[model samples]
Target chain A: MKRLWGPASLLAILLVVALMGSLALGEVRLAPSEVLSVLMGRGSDLARTVVLDFRLPRALVGIAVGASLAASGVLMQSFFRNPLASPGLLGVSTGGALGAVAALALGWTANSIFALPLASISGAFLATFAVMALAKREASAEHLLLAGVALNALFGAATSFLLNLTAGRFEVSGQIIFWMLGGLENRTWSHVWMALPGTVLGCMMLLPLGRSMNLLSLGEQGAQSLGVNVRRLQWEIIILSTVLTALATAVGGVIGFVGLVVPHILRLAIGPDHRRLLPLSMIGGAAFVLVCDLITRFLPGELRLGVVTALIGGPFFLWMLRRPS
Target chain B: MIRTERINLGTRLRDVSLHLLKGSLTAVVGPNGAGKSTLLQVLAGLLKAEGAIAWMGDDLNSISFPERGRRLAWVGQDLHADFAFSVRDVVAQGRHAFGDDDEFIDSAMKALDIENLADRSVTRLSGGERRRVFLARALATNAPIHLWDEPTANLDVRHGLDVLQLATKLRNEGRAVLISLHDLRAALCFDQVLVLDRGHLAAAGNPDDVLTPELIHRVFGVKARMGQEMILELP
Candidate 1:
């Protein structure tokens, strides 16, 4: 219990500070107290609009998306027993992108905001399930990764095809490309509402799976002998992780690496007990993305969120691989 | 008791019948590709076969996964600790069906003389130490039946003997223990032995009766002696 307190408190403090920093250090540059006053419902209209209407939802959505992706990453790594496994690398997020793009291309969003998210969720599910089925049929970790690679290409190509089809409609094509690049700029409370339920549900579902996931890390036969229904558990993890990743993608385009890097770092610091790893990665991921978003907002140009994550994550991953384990 | 009738698993294993009894340790011996591991898997209910396998009198298939887990503990030939977890953590996994109890994990580690290594990362342990950790996991399960596939492989003499002695202890405790082995001498000490050849049950019965020199030559295709201690000459 005491062991949890130190890291847990540290992450909580980091998250609060990042949240405050994101709220206070944007274009208007308000103080922490000013942001707090607005959050407590007593600030001027401009302060309320900037802090509550704008930055607060953006930061909250970033936290939710970060937490979701990180949680998904933990699940993927444990499910595959490979530290490198993640929704982004596996084409799951790409599948979600294709879904959102398809919804936009078909003008479904004009009907309702819900249509795009529902489509993205289904798309994520299909991609994840396809990869899982391939993994099962192949029965090799390396092969599963290969399947992910192929699926990623297929999804990317499909997304490209959709973009090409929408080229005549500048508005639709712009939306598609921007979503594919992935960002959280100009996001609103509605986006927070869109992602929060799935993230919460996914975390709740993934939390209990920690023990089963821990057992699974021992290898399939070992886990089965301990009474785990490996196939069923895999399906559960696939559904939850896909849904979470899809929701995040729907709200924030295709933010990468929060899932990949946050869990890997936390595993190194805290060890591989998913019981602790799952929840801690959530807090760490929220802090990580909030900080990353802060960095992106301060940059000279309009850099995409996924680009920043890949820049930071790719090198961190390389350094990790170079480090002696 | 575990009894299988005409169990077949595609071409890898065919027409295999077995009777594994409690209060005894049964040794399964065979050459490579002879289905020794497959037989243990079928009995452990980890693999489905096109035949009836019963635990006591109930159909093994009808028994739920968790129920079977409580009844049987299995240790596979290949041991992997890909993730960094302590030796005690690996052993504690055995208690999944029964829930967390530090005492069982502690005793299991102690029995394998790994109490000192309990806090050490399993991935960092030596091959023999990792084998012991796996064996300790099976022991910690406290299941009525144990199926171990080549449990002594990669173990040194002392640790190898520890595994054999542990099998004997479990048998004495009235649990059924089935061990697949490449070690003929170790198999010779078990109460009963089942010899397999090309997925066929070549021989079965008392080890003393089944492990004849001629049978060893015919089934294993090796010149062997079964005297006070079984000795083999590889081809």
Candidate 2:
């Protein structure tokens, strides 16, 4: 427990810096002093509107989304006992993407702001249930992963079909493509509210299961012999991780590697004890997305948030694979 | 003290009944498909069989998982430690059922002579060392009943002897120690021997009586002679 303090402190510091950077560095480019003044309720109306109404909600959403995805990743990796497992391993992201794209293609986004996220979450839940149903007989981690893979392919194909149908309508096709690429642009307090409560509640529930998850690393029968309720733990992990992934994808629109990369890096830095790894992954994940989102702001010509993360995380993951453990 | 009556598991194990006593070291010996592992797993409460497994006259299923865990410490065959958890971390997991016990973890590691490797990752350890780490993990449980499936499989000769000595020590402490063995010679040191042939209890009693040359040949399908100190197989 004592060993966790240093890395936890470092990640906390990085999260704060990233949050500040996200608030200060944007299209309007407020100075640190001005950002602080606006935060302190002493700035001009324009600065106040930009900082308080716009940047704060966007930054908060990034933190919540990042933390949610990373924590979800930790759960998936530990539950499956496979480091390669991520939030998308269960098809939640693709399912959510399909729902959001279908909504946009069918003109549901114009109905209400909540329509996109609600549809996305419903789609994610359906995909997860489908995977569960397909793998219900076996219910092993390997079987669930295989089921997830099959569902992911099906969902991806369906998303493409929607894209094809909307090809003649440039506006609809463009919106679909933009949502798929993923960005935190024009995010509001509603997005923050949509993500924060569930992420906080889900992570809180997952934190105490760390020791049981450690026992789970010993294999199914090994863990069972150690008094872990393997079946119950499996259900808890599936529900919690799926909810987190759906919430993040609903708001962030398929932000990819924060889930995979954050947990992987934190596991390397701090040992594989989920007690430390889960919380650190939360902080690390939020910081990673915030930093990545900041980079999107600096880059020329409309680089998407998901594109930047994949660009960075893909190469880093390849390098990690090349390096021997 | 543990007792089983007419235990059966899908074709793997059938009608195997056995009794174990405190302060005794018992060895379960059988061929590859002889259900030795299935018996151990059933006894450990990791598998449910058709018949009754009672601990001190209480039905095994009646005991809660945590209570059962505190009573039985199981070391499975070919258990994999794929993650880079430190040896100490893995050993500490033995105390998980009873909550944290650094003293038990330390003593368990020391008993297995793995104190120096406590900080090393279990994933990086050799087969023998990894086996010791898992054995230490079971030892850390401080449970009265220890169920080990092929505990000495990957160990060197000295380590194998050490494990036998540790089992004897545990038995001396008035705990029941049951191990499944592929090494017939090691079975000689046990107080009682159970010879399982095709999920049946072919023979059970004092090792000297149960492991007779004729019984060995009948159960194991091997012609053997009991030499001065070892059993020799004949073609």
Candidate 3:
């Protein structure tokens, strides 16, 4: 759709410039022309490797990871109807991490690239399922949020216990740590391959239901008058959010705060119609994750992407939480 | 276009039998818990109506969801929220069923006099402003049937008159508007009134003949008298 032409477009244009900077400002510092050549398939070996093999994959991961989290964030926020709701708030990220750890623990995924995301997806699905089962009988936004908090705690406990049990295994432990902290250190095209399908699928499922979501904001009884099949839509949304979250978590482990911050900022800018809101969130999310990845990869050190996001988002989150309603 | 016979909507609606015609401003008036809202929901294809709501003489449930949404527009209660949206965005929700028709949205915004507020956030609007925005959204749906759950609740007296006058205009345009109102004066101004008392239909007819002193006393448990010009004076 050729519709978005306001704050969202400016952000998108800025992202394009930032993406160019991201490809150029790394260790080797390739010129824009060199980066273009590498993208267009005719560059020096180091430029090609730096831009295509290393920086390109990293940048792509940033966009995908950011977008997936942001869209998932928007969906979950709308799903729970709480401004504070996010993938992290609901503990879906932790659950997916545990699933990735489980896949590692099984020792069957050492050679398989799909194992991590698949496990994360399953874990995310299970965690959300547990939340749903606990509060299904009296399901309100508050109850659902409480259920997410409780399940998040339980999943955290389980993941910690698994970490404690597998303390000596470096490969498994390292994978778990990197996954837990979140990173795009050596992400390949295959990682991009895995994340793209589900994110696209999730977008396909959720955007068409945007009007139904608007009806939902009017509250439950209000929705029924608009012919909204509330239960069915709720289920689809929960599952779609889980799937998208899992895909991101599986590819890059549990990145936090993109879901929390991006949609909210965009909502403040564009308001709450999912049609406009969701698209803006996608652009903003991609920008946020790309910026974070730029910081993590080019800023020199073992500071994990997850840790960087937490450090940035933590104060912002608390500031948001405490800044008076 | 709503026909219900022996459709049990639990406690609110008990073995109700009613047929509501289209293209007139029909007021559903009652006290609290009179099942007026429930009946409106049933007619709008919102509730899990067991019996049929024949839309143009076809089974309502048998049709698809999008079709139903395009056919019926509902203005619900308690629509206020903490989340801020522009008056334009909120009103654009009505045209959602119309499949992104910009022409429809442009005129709908103009009709509701919310064109100036298009860029302004809805959270900052006054009570009457908010109510008018919601009404504008419902109108933008361009559906033939409109169900409003106290559409004039928060409006000032002047705005309330505007709402009623707008309803009259919509009705005259051959659109069906069934609104539930606690205000008897507003109900009297409507083309027709359906009196509900304790989840049962007390009476149904023109505002004058149907809203008799006896029916008023029976429904509201209040002594009432009528004078010339069909003015109702109540105690």
Candidate 4:
């Protein structure tokens, strides 16, 4: 228990700071005390509305989405035994994008709030099943990775085709492109509610599987010799990771790098013990996205959340690749 | 005791009928690609095999994989270090079904003289050290039966001897230990030997009886003799 304190506490502190940053530092800057007063129901209407109605939901959504993506990233990397693996790489996020874009183009999102997420969830499951089918045909990790790449390209092409179909309608095309860019801007309590259940469920499902994931790092035959049902575990992990990634994509669009970068950073900071790494990556991921969102909020020209993450994460990834392991 | 009859697995292994008894160490010897690894994998239940396998009069198929895991531990020919995990963590995985037992890990590490490497990342370990780490992991299971495929493939003479000695220790403790080896001299130390040729069980008996020069020459395409020490020479 004591051994967990150093990294866990550090991550906890960072998350709190990022959350506060998300709440206070925005278009209308409020002091920490002003945000606190708003929370206590004592602030003026403008402060209350700005902090409670706008910033709060966006920050909450950012945290939830970030944590979900990061947690799923940990599972993906462990499952594939590839550090480069993340939920986005497997076409799960692309599937969600396609689903949500399809929903928008069909004008189903206007009729009901649940339609987009439901469609996104189905899309995610479809992508995961497609990847699983490829994996079943060939049990090697490299083959599965190649299959994921193919699925990603296929999903990307399908999504672009949907966007092309909506080109005649300026409003729908703009909405699809905005969502694809990915952001916390204009996110509301509905978005938070939409992402909350899947995030919580994905975490619950993934946490207990940490031990099995650790064992899996030894490779399939080694894991089996230790009594792990490799096939079953892979299926469960795929489903849960898809849920997490799909839900986040449904609400926040295709936020990149949160999953890949957060877990990778945490693994380096604290050793790769999934028992600790999984939960810590959740916290670190929430903070990372929140901080990145906060940065985007201050940057001129209303930068997309995905652009901000790629701008920072792309270089870091390259540097990591160049470094001797 | 483990008994198999006409257990054919894949195109590589066919008609492999053998028995492994408790309180004995069995050495599996074969030329390259002669289905040695496949035989061990079949016995470990990692491969689907046709025909009958019984363990202590109970059908091997009836036992659950986890239950089979509790009874048998296997060390493969390669332990890939694609990720960075501590030596202790690697050994701890062997205790998955049995739960965490620090004493078991400690004793296994001690057996392989890798106690000081408990916290060191496995990726940094030398080939010989990594081989010992894998051996320690298999030993840490404390299973009643052990199947090891070339556990000493990259080890020095001293460490290779250490592996055989550990097998000897496990046999003395009334555990069934099956190991594959390229070293005929090391295989000669085991209580029983099973030799393979082109996926067929060419010989099985006491090492002295089954590992004759003529049999070695026929199976391995090499001239061999067991005098003061076993020797293999090009034909």
List each candidate's DockQ score.
0.70, 0.67, 0.32, 0.66
CA-lDDT, candidates in order: 0.85, 0.89, 0.77, 0.85
**Interface alpha-carbon RMSD, every candidate:** 1.1, 1.2, 2.5, 1.2
Better of 1 and 3 by lDDT: 1
Which residue pairs of candidate 3 clash?
A117-A250
Higher DockQ: candidate 2 or 3? 2
- Residue-wise C-alpha lDDT for candidate 3, range A1-325, written one tens digit per residue: 4345777779899789879987898668888999899889898999988887777777787787888889888877777767678876666788888888888777758777777778888898788777778888548778888887887888888888888777898877777777789988888888877887667777777777776787676566555544566778888777777777878888888888889888877776666777777767877888888788778765666678888888888898899889654
Query: Which prediction has the highest lDDT against the true structure?
Result: 2
Give fnat for candidates 1, 2 and onward, in order.
0.75, 0.62, 0.35, 0.58
Model 3 DockQ, alpha carbons vs. true complex: 0.32
Interface RMSD of 1: 1.1
Q: Write out the backbone clash pairs for model 1.
A: none
Fnat value of model 4: 0.58
Estimate the TM-score of every prediction.
Answer: 0.94, 0.96, 0.85, 0.95
Q: Who wins the DockQ comparison?
A: 1
Ranking by TM-score: 2, 4, 1, 3
| Worst 10 contiguous positions by lDDT, candidate 1 chain B | B226-235
Which CAPRI category fits model 2? medium
lDDT of 3 by residue, B35-133 (tens): 988888777776675665677577886867667767778877765655676777777777555565654666777766678888887778887788778
Predicted complex 1: DockQ: 0.70
Over A1-325, each residue of candidate 1 has an lDDT whose tens digit, in order, gives 3356789899999999999999998789998888889989888889888988889888989999899999999988887787877877667898888899999998999998788777887888788788878878425667777888999999999989988889889998988888777788888878888888768878997898888889897787888888888878877887788888988988888888788899888877888888889999999999998998888887889778878888899898888789776
